[model samples]
Target: MARVETLKRQFFKCLGLLAGCTSFALWASQPQVVEKADKTELEWGNVLFEYYQKDYFEALIEYEYAKTINNDTAKSDYGQMLQGGMLLSYGQAKQSQEIFDRVLARSADPLVRNRAWYYLANLYYHKSEPEKAHQSLAKISGPVPSDLFPEFYHLTSLINSDVENLAQAENILSQVPEDSKHYPYVLFNVAIGQLRSNELKKSLINLTKVNQYAARSEEHASLSDRATHGLAQLALKSGNLPTAWANLQKIRTNGLYSNRGLLTYAWTAIKIKQFNEAIPALEILQSRDIAIPEVQEAKVLLAHLYEQQGAPRKALKSNLISIDEFAKGINRVAEARDIIAKQNVPEEFVRNLDVIIDDSDWFGAQPSIDYQKLTPFLIDLMSSRILNETLKELSDLYAIKKNLENWEFQSNEHLLIMNNADKKSISKEERKAIQRSKAIQQQLSDKKQELKLLMLSLKPEEQKRFQSTIDSIDKEIAILQSRTDGMSRLSQPYKQPASVKKEMKDKHNQVKQKLKQTSRLIAKLEPVVRSLVNEELDKHEERMRYYWAQSRLAKARLYDTTLMELDNVTSNKESGEGVK
Candidate 1:
């Protein structure tokens, strides 16, 4: 059996050499796993069958059985690498890495080593260690499968932000033999790399090559769709309106991109002032997935189209639709509030939405309907009222804190002056000075009370809503009093202990956070309410238009039908009289 195995390897090696040096190198490197196995042959065969059927775990069992055959290094390495690759496919990265590491250490054949390296590089890429992946790729400098060279360059191109490597990636792809099975894939990756590098012209050239190659093959419909869309984007970017529109029209007509492609097409239409042309595309977008940002942009653009068509009111109605959509998006509202911090709510609200919604927002604020008063409709639909209120409350809180700090500093200064007087030695005039110090102490007490009252006024609801918290603070204040002397002096240390200060700060922060949260909720809800009003208004408008169109069409059809009947009756009477 050992002699027969040797003969088989010698024959296979000759065939491999004739196939090419790359194939020979690969075959020489790959471990021949089949062994003079007795019961293990049946078990491993069954495992191979199961692996083909995608039953990885059962196949894994057979793999283990075959590997357990003592003294078969090839079988063991093959089993481990196959299992590792399967595990990697299933997202078990760490286990896959360990298994591949063992395979690399034991495998003597270049082919198996290259395979292991490829898988390891992929694992590293998935783990987000692209640099490590590039390093792993570097180990396969020996004769490799021509088909894998493009993928190698593709991955290397991803190692940096520069376009220089992208050209190298393209050169690698161009090396594929004309008869290579993976020619289309090489071209696709090269084009995608070019696109990333912003070499749009070269990207288009490669994509066109991919399209032509796939067209000749009668396979790869999805690849064709991708290439078509790629060309459309290129055309759009290059201001080749006719060509871009034509390419996008292919995707739209074939219903390939469905909702997504049509949305892109609509923008192209809007770009060329073909406002009405954009309507149908926008309508298709409206009927599809509504959550995508593109759908929202379509709505805004649709409104602009309507405005361009001499319907300003319809335009505002459209913008209002987007505002309502965004209201439901919690993250989007948070984003808007962030903007509100830097800009006024009303002016910035309209314009910020323009920016956030899409670049079409650059068209600036579209004219709204001529409506007197900030109608609950406009308020509910168009305003970020809640954000405004929250901002005001926050400003007031800061102002009150500043006032409190000033009062505390002044009171402390006055007390320190009194203490200095006490420390001084003087005559009867000093006794008079001490009386003056007493008056100053009284004034300081009154001023402290006033400051306390001011703080309470700022948080008027705190005593009622947060009674326990207020009581806790009062208790701490009382404790501080116990530690101080009543000589208009602080019996407690003037400087607060870290623990005490931290406790006070924590309580203050908790209250502040709660207020901010409440204010935000209120702010967020205000737009929702306004949006509800706006939405209701929009719905009413839509229904009215629908009903009016229906009514007019019904009337016109009925009138035509009545006129036909009358003419038929007259013709019948004239015929009867002539016959008589």
Candidate 2:
């Protein structure tokens, strides 16, 4: 009986040992989460992660928070954000330059210094100071971040191009790897350089490569359209009408190349005696925005096509329309020039008027009587009154503009989603989902602030209960964030409704009609406004002249009285001498 009990105990101990080893193996196989050593470092990492994701607003918020902590990395990142125009307008380039200069001058970290130099170079480039840009680029000696390498090379090539150093630009462009996102841009610019140099064969080869890559990737549509347009131009120059037509056909309508492409297409069709094709292309070009420079050319082409089709009256009408458009354009220019000449107000005042006119809500509930003493305030009041009355008279038009803006925003959002879907990347979709979640999280954070305000009104017992609820919300948020961190980058594609698109288009047309009507009203009213402003200024000038004349007369009277006093003194002296 003792031997049987001992055997059972030994077998149980072996089974327990085997179970422990299996648990240890499972633990070893699982992925590990490494915690950052410092709290500030973790926060700084979060800022960098947000920046990498192109969540500039979130990055800026995190950076602002991180700045209170004594961390050099956080300071460097904040400076980088300022220099990159992520947290400010590009108009603040001078301020950005100053921040970069401080980092470059004082940063002990080589990496920080290099980034500062890179951003400084970009600023100089934008400012059109290429020599200074080159100097800034020279300051970057050490290794740069991988993501910035392509930008560095591209900027270098651009600077070379700006200086007309085609050889150097070509050499620099050659260093850009095929897989770089900037590769297509570099290739296009290089082809342009070759074309300018009259290296037709080389240019064609490079352009063809860009076209093929853009088509296969289904990206950079603008670049692809440009490449096709370039090919068309080349074919036309080489007298290859068919090739030119084919190249022009590849270019999508309503693109950067559209007007020129359509015009070229029509001309090429005319060359091939395809009147039917030529007429449609010309008509399409004419139907485009009147603001387009090609509209007049398209009219002439249409007139020619009409004449060829033996429709003399139609051709005459086309010519008449072209002349009418030109006359209207000249009248507009003359009126603008006249206003500028007569209205001698400062440019700043005019710009202020522009702002107030464009945004009715700019003043926010109108200014008080005290504030009306300010020139800007007065101008805003006048402009707001004018715009409000105009809008009231054209209430239907105003409603259309409002609806148009709202529908346009929604349409654009849907279009953006569809465009993102075209990329077909799980990682990208995940990032977008994360961004949406973060936006909601931001709203929740704002709610917490509001809740804190509400706490002031609560009794002690109620406060405690409210605080508990807040704490629970905080915990849920933390859990959501944790889950977000582990989520895979996958999302379903978004498709916008056809009805939404149609509504957007309809609203756009209504807004456009309203704009034209408003423009005509302004055309009549602008002259009156200009005359009033000019009259006011003339009155001011007249008042100044009258004051000057009055001062001159007083001076003359003073001079006459001084002379008389001197003469009287002389006569008195003579009479005293005779009495003696």
Candidate 3:
């Protein structure tokens, strides 16, 4: 029995030494956990194992259980953080925030408090409260263990972006270790933050790092494409055309760039004066069936190139087609308005239908034709028809004026004879004659009043439009009045009132002159204006025909121009080099 006890004691001593060495090794390996632990916490070991195994849900359950047994505030904080992180992994952002808040409020140990604050900041940031998140992160003030430094820097960078404190955010991100799992992510955030702050060169550096570190991540792939495109844009802005082109080419290879990317590339090519190179890309964009705004722009650009290459008709046709396809296609309303104002289907269309307002002879009747019926016909008129129709209407206006003048002259002569008969005696025949003269004068007065009223009623805009006609009628009426006043002074046949003949003649002449001037001016201006209109119509017809022929008969037009030059050149060659 004594020999067995001695052996057992020796075995226990050896076992105690082994346990001491094992505890020392564990402490050396994880000093942060070891120094703070009062006992061997199997719960932390289990929780960490679950986390490493990617069993985040089970790890959270274990951490919650660990929190109940954790006497140290720091350990409890770690457990709560683990729980919150697990909740975040499951997309329970609100629950994660609540746990992080509890850890921050309840944990009193410095390491635990700082960690809780850091994670709580991240929680707030994830919840879009970057200001609150930044405040929480600002509380961390100690040497961060390597494992926690990544989360610290990343969270700091994100919170910096939230508060628009990109520069500080960049500094925090730079402190992260190079070999960290979050290195690439931090670099990307630093670059993006620097970009937001307009630190292009610095941003470029971080972006470069991001490209190197995140090569296998989605962020790496996307960041590469964006950085290349961004560099290209910067190159273009700085006038480095070749570099811009090279960068844009790289961007195009990356599938992440959109049509807008394509457009930028094309425009950059244009800036470098590589018009021909731009043409293919622009044409490809133009040929798309969908009416994307860029497609319209591409068509416009292509059309412009065609124009510069001696293809105005082609350019014009493209513009017309684009307008028809989508009125809002090009996103240039003012440009469209100007184009329509200047070249909208040609001015000749307005002139072609023989739409004339006759101003000559001042009588308003130009066969009393409808102006509305003519608008469409004018728009559709052949170049020759406009000229013919304009002349015909002008003639009709002049003839109508002459008829009106003859009727006025006959009425005046009859009134003069009746007035003379009324002045002779009180005989039945003389009384009847006086009555006839009075009635005739009253009718002439009424007609004059009606013409004066018509003149008075014209709106200013309308009056200005017909001012030439109005002026002419007034001058004619003035001359007629002078002649009538002189006649009345020489012979007053009605003694009842010689004043009546003067007044009646004065009013009649005024009415006649106003009406005549209005009609005549309308007639003259109508034809003159219509002639201008016809000229415009002819021009439009020429343009329309040119565009139609160019689009459908390009070969014919090109051949026609080349044929004469070719013949001259050939004849010269046949004769001699010196032949004229």
Q: For each of the candidates, give the backbone clash count.
A: 12, 1, 24
Model 1, which residues run further than 4 Å from truth? 1-40, 69-75, 142-164, 175-182, 196-198, 213-222, 253-258, 312-580
Candidate 3 or 1, higher lDDT? 3
lDDT of 3 by residue, 393-470 (tens): 444344445545665776678568658766664456544544543444444444444444554565556546445643
CA lDDT, every model vs. true structure: 0.56, 0.62, 0.57
> Model 2, stretches more than 4 Å misplaced?
1-36, 42-68, 75-91, 105-113, 138-142, 216-219, 238-242, 271-276, 320-580
Ranking of all candidate structures by their TM-score, best first: 2, 1, 3
The superposed Cα distance between candidate 2 and the true structure at residue 539, in angstroms, equals 35
Q: Give me candidate 1's TM-score against the actual structure.
A: 0.45
TM-score winner, 1 or 2? 2
> Which runs of model 3 end up more than 4 angstroms from their true locations?
1-75, 91-95, 106-110, 145-148, 179-185, 195-218, 238-243, 258-260, 280-580
* Model 3 Cα shift for residue 13 (angstroms): 41
Query: By how many angstroms RMSD does model 2 differ from the true structure?
Result: 29.3
Predicted candidate 2 versus true structure: per-residue lDDT over 1-580, tens digit per residue: 4643443454345344434433433312334465654665787787878877876656666777777775566666544644355532323466667777766666777677777787877767766688888778777777776767898888876676566567867876787888887888888887887888888998899888887666544456778888999999899989998989888999887765678878888889988888898888888876764334455467666876776787755765666665555454434434433444543222223334444444454455343221112232122234344443333333323333354556555766756665665565456645666676555556555666656665655556756755666676666556544554544332543455667666656766675676666555545544554454445434433433343343334334444655887899999999999999
